[model samples]
Target: MSKRGGSRNPSSERARGRDREERREREREREREREREREKRERERETEREREREREREREIEREREIESEREREREREREREREREGERGREGERHWKNRREGHDGEKSGVCVCACTRERERERERERERERERERERERERERERGRERE
Candidate 1:
């Protein structure tokens, strides 16, 4: 009876030791799975952060492009305005030149008319004096007419 009881105690101890080792192996596998899950989560978060940063950079680039385009348009408009103003000033100068030419022509024509009137008056006075001398010399003696004409 003592030998049987001792053999039974050793068999029961061996079974408990096998069960403990199996339990330990299962726990290790569970820990490994949890670690893998944690690593995957960290990788997913990093990828999302990178994508967000890229999106922000793209938006900033677009804003800069828009601002540059607006500045170019404003500069072009100012240049056009200056060109128009110069054209207007040139036109005004031309008009003033034309007006001055017209005034000079009018002054020359008035001077020519006054010179013609003076020439006509001098010719009429010479004709009237020649007629009066012919009337005073009617039927005079030859020698006396010659003396009076000379005096």
Candidate 2:
């Protein structure tokens, strides 16, 4: 009798099964590659974010340093003003002592009328000097404000 038409070839079936398994493995490998690529992208984004944060922090530090420097300059200017005021006071004291000595000498050597006139002239000169000094101090303060405001 002829072989039955429905009979299957066992070797051919095994070969087909092996083919399917290999295809599935290839697909699994592709999926793993895609997953690795996604993880790499995420890491890159995280690194970029960290860099941005660091740059911003550096900028903040620079601003703080500039503000501190400005404050220091202001303090220095105030100290200089105080020193000038002290010097002016010393000068005025010297002038007053000189005037007192001159008046004592004139009292012994000059007539009373001439001594009185000289005293008036010395008093007027001292007043004029005081007025000039006040104007100079005001001008210096104005200049200081102008120069410091821009820097």
Candidate 3:
């Protein structure tokens, strides 16, 4: 009877051990699934961050292109202004040459000389201001380039 009872006891103990092992296996599978989900979420977050960074870079590039266009326009305006001044000077010289050589001493010639002197002084001042503006623009360009590099 004692031997029979001991044999029954081992069989029940083995059944309980198998049930515990199965539960442990199920828990391990759940843990593995959780780990996979966490990794997936982390990868997704990283991908989003990369996309945001690219977007910021594109925006900055667009701004830089716009700024460059504006600078080009400003330079064109400056060139046009200088050309107009040169044209005015040339026209005046031509007028003076024609008037003095072809015509007799005229009142118009006196007025023209006085006007030319005043215009020359004003032109000198404008040229100085233009030079200052050019210097300032060059400095601004250098600074912008540096800022773009940093950003």
Candidate 4:
């Protein structure tokens, strides 16, 4: 004779335990999947940040190169202007040498003309100096802007 509801069935108890374990394992797997997804998102975000940083660096390098090119152009222009001034000086000297063979009155007139020409050249040189100063100021301003960008 068995007790009516006092004894538990062993098979039923084992099946319930197995079902609980399966549910717990499924929950653990879901947690692991969520963690993997989070890690993947973080990796993607880091990659994007690196790419953006690289792009910005490239742009900065390009700007620096452009500034250098502009400075080179300015130097070239100054050199050309100096060469032109030297050629003019050579021409004036040649003229003076020829004037030595002429009469006194003609030589005096040539000297006066040379003096006037020197004064005109001095005035032109002063104007060019002012222009060069302005350009230098502009370059300095650009450098300041680049430094600000760097900062």
Name the best candidate (by lDDT): 4
TM-score to native of every candidate shown: 0.51, 0.53, 0.55, 0.55
List the lowest-lDDT window of 10 residues for candidate 2: 105-114
Cα lDDT of model 3 by residue, 77-127, tens digit? 998888788873576566654444223654344334446666888999999
Off by over 4 Å in 3: 1-8, 90-101, 104-151
Model 2 CA deviation exceeding 4 Å by range: 1-7, 90-151
Query: How would you encode candidate 4's per-residue C-alpha lDDT over 1-151 as one tens digit per residue?
Result: 7767888889998999999999999999999999999999999999999999999999999999999999999999998888788773576566654544445555433343456567888999999999999999999999999999999
List clashing residue pairs in candidate 3.
Answer: none
RMSD of 3: 16.5
Candidate 1 lDDT (Cα, whole model)? 0.74
Off by over 4 Å in 4: 1-5, 90-151
Model with the higher TM-score, candidate 1 or 3: 3
Taking every candidate in turn, the Cα RMSD to the unseen true structure, in Å, is 31.3, 14.8, 16.5, 16.6
lDDT by residue (72-149, candidate 2, tens digit) is 999999988887887625754444444444355465332333455578899999999999999999999999999999
User: Per-residue lDDT of 7-112 in model 1, one digit per residue for the tens?
Assistant: 5577878999999999999999999999999999999999999999999999999999999999999999998887788762565444433444234546422222
Could you arrange the candidates by lDDT from highest to lowest?
Answer: 4, 3, 2, 1
- Pick out the ten consecutive residues of candidate 4 with the lowest summed lDDT: 105-114
Residue 7, model 2, lDDT:
69
Each model's lDDT? 0.74, 0.82, 0.83, 0.85
